[model samples]
Target: MRITKIRATPVAVPYRTDETWAFGSRSGMVSVLVELDTDEGIVGLGEAAAYPSAEIVLSVLKSVERLVVGADPFRIEQLIQRIDVVGTWHHVKATSPAIAAVEAACWDIVGKACGQPLVNLFGGRFRDSVEFFYYVAAPDPDTVKAEGTRATAAGFTTCYLKVGSDSLDIDIERVAALRDGIGPHMNIRIDANEAWTAGTALRAVRAMLPYGLELVEQPVSGRNLQQLAYVRGRMDVPMLANEACWTRYDQLSVIHNGAADVLSVDNQMDGGLLNLKRSAGLCAAAGMTVLKHSLGELGVALAAATHVIAATPNFRHANQAYGALLSDDIVDGFGGGVDNYRDGCLDVPTGPGIGVALDPDRVARYARLYREHGDTEFSFQHPRALTTGLALPKH
Candidate 1:
């Protein structure tokens, strides 16, 4: 059926705690929720993470309205091709989240029409449930330890922490505290987010080796594959490529250069759910593991990616999610807080399409929240952070 209309709503959902990273901090998640209404009276849902900003995502949706409207929802590839080629959004990475939201909505419509879940259409169930890591917000050593204890108590097997702070000594202390809190059983994964030089990465990782890291993510910049490979060769811990592999083309280069043992893939960053599956297949061919990377998504986006991750093989490790941090969600019973997870895993929704429906009350609440405070509170660029100069490689 043809798409009749597209409605895009920007929502800001508060986090339990501020998500502090190497560059900046955001108090919550800001997403552009997309709804595609079809001629056959079918409506599909999609969610786009406000990558750079909600304004950009809204502008992208407006720009592609002509390309998306009056298009066949079933012919997703063709529709995406038009948006990429005809709309000239192919080269712009920032436009991807909006494009991906449209594509995901189309897939949702297709699944509903076929009376099948997205996992079945993608390749059936390689797994019944998808595992996700508990996100530990970087704070003081004691707070980090407390978060680790909370994650462990919640039955999560893996915990993800952001490193590459202003001081390596502080990062080391935090890691040590997390290890102490989680005890010896659980895994600790750290993401530097391309905040260190190769030399500094080596020194920093070496210092934290005693705490036992599961994987070190993007210790150096993603631009230089040789530098990544250099760090990978010298370190015993496995490396996960994040910024280095945003697209399939980047994934190919990472494979060729042996830049990482695992790759981080995101449909929001690339194009859509289909490309996310393609990313997994590409990494599988290279005998490398891949995990989903989040730009802070809510239930709609989380459920869409869950369907793909559950159906795909080689996603052996726990993927990333904002479960530990999201204070609430717009969707009803899935993917908001730690309560929704069973030992760090989310059961795939068995309903047709993406299978998670939005709660109108919560949606309106968060939508109003977005309108009132999205610019200041939910922003990725903190006002204080803008005044301070950021020198990369944190040496």
Candidate 2:
């Protein structure tokens, strides 16, 4: 069926707690949701990790919204290429949230057309569920211990602690205390957010080695692949490439160059679900693994990531966090809900088309923050009245 309309709305959702990483302290999250309408009464949905100042996301949507409003949603790959060609003409950001929005919306429509989850349509399933790692926001040893204890008590078995922002000695003490509090059985990973240099990364990894850390993410700056390789070669635990890598090209550079042991693929930041799958294949080809990266994505992208990781044998557990941590969302916050995570594992959603639906009321409420009090919310009227010219016969 031909796509008849494309609309994008930005929303502001407060965070449950201020998450402090090397980047900065985040008090709220900004996201853009895309809705695609088709001739055959189908609606596709997508979400992106939006920042207030991200001109790319805004421009990408504004540029493509009207053009795709009368095209065939079923031809998703072709549509993506059209986006690329247009982006080349305009020279917008490569991985804009708007691109992610359109891609995700196309997936939603395609999944619904096939009566499958997005992953099943892509390659079928290799896993039924994915495990989550808790990101504890603490700056000191005591706070780290307390947060780790709370997470453990809440049944989270894998936890990600932020490092590389404080002094080496403070980070060492925090890691030691967290590992001790979580017990030896719990898996602990650390995210530096590209704050450390090669020397500091080596030193920090060495100091934290005895705690049985699962991985150290973005240990060194993203730009210096040589230094990343140097640190990766010397580190006791696997070095996870987060910000340093995004696409198949990036993954290949790291793998062939021996810069990383594991690749963290953030679907939103990298491109979209399809790009993430490509990155996973590249990593698998190089005898490496993929960890679904996090970029403060909402439930739509999280659900997509779950399906993608579950379908790929080469992908390990995803770094899907924030659902339980975000105070607001379009869909019911998938994780952090009672059944969202149980015993460290999350059950795959069984509903069709990414297994989630947006809350129109919440969408309306949050859209006001970005647009006129009522202008940005996606209403049934918008999709219902979309004029889809004759194309393929309605199913």
Candidate of highest TM-score: 1
C-alpha root-mean-square deviation, candidate 2: 9.9
Tens digits of per-residue lDDT, candidate 1, 179-210, equal 99999989999999999999989998899999
lDDT of each: 0.92, 0.73
Q: For every model shown, what is its TM-score relative to the native structure?
A: 0.98, 0.88
What lDDT is reached at residue 2 by model 1?
Answer: 96
The residue pairs in collision within model 1 are none
For candidate 2, the lDDT comes to 0.73
Which candidate tops lDDT? Answer: 1
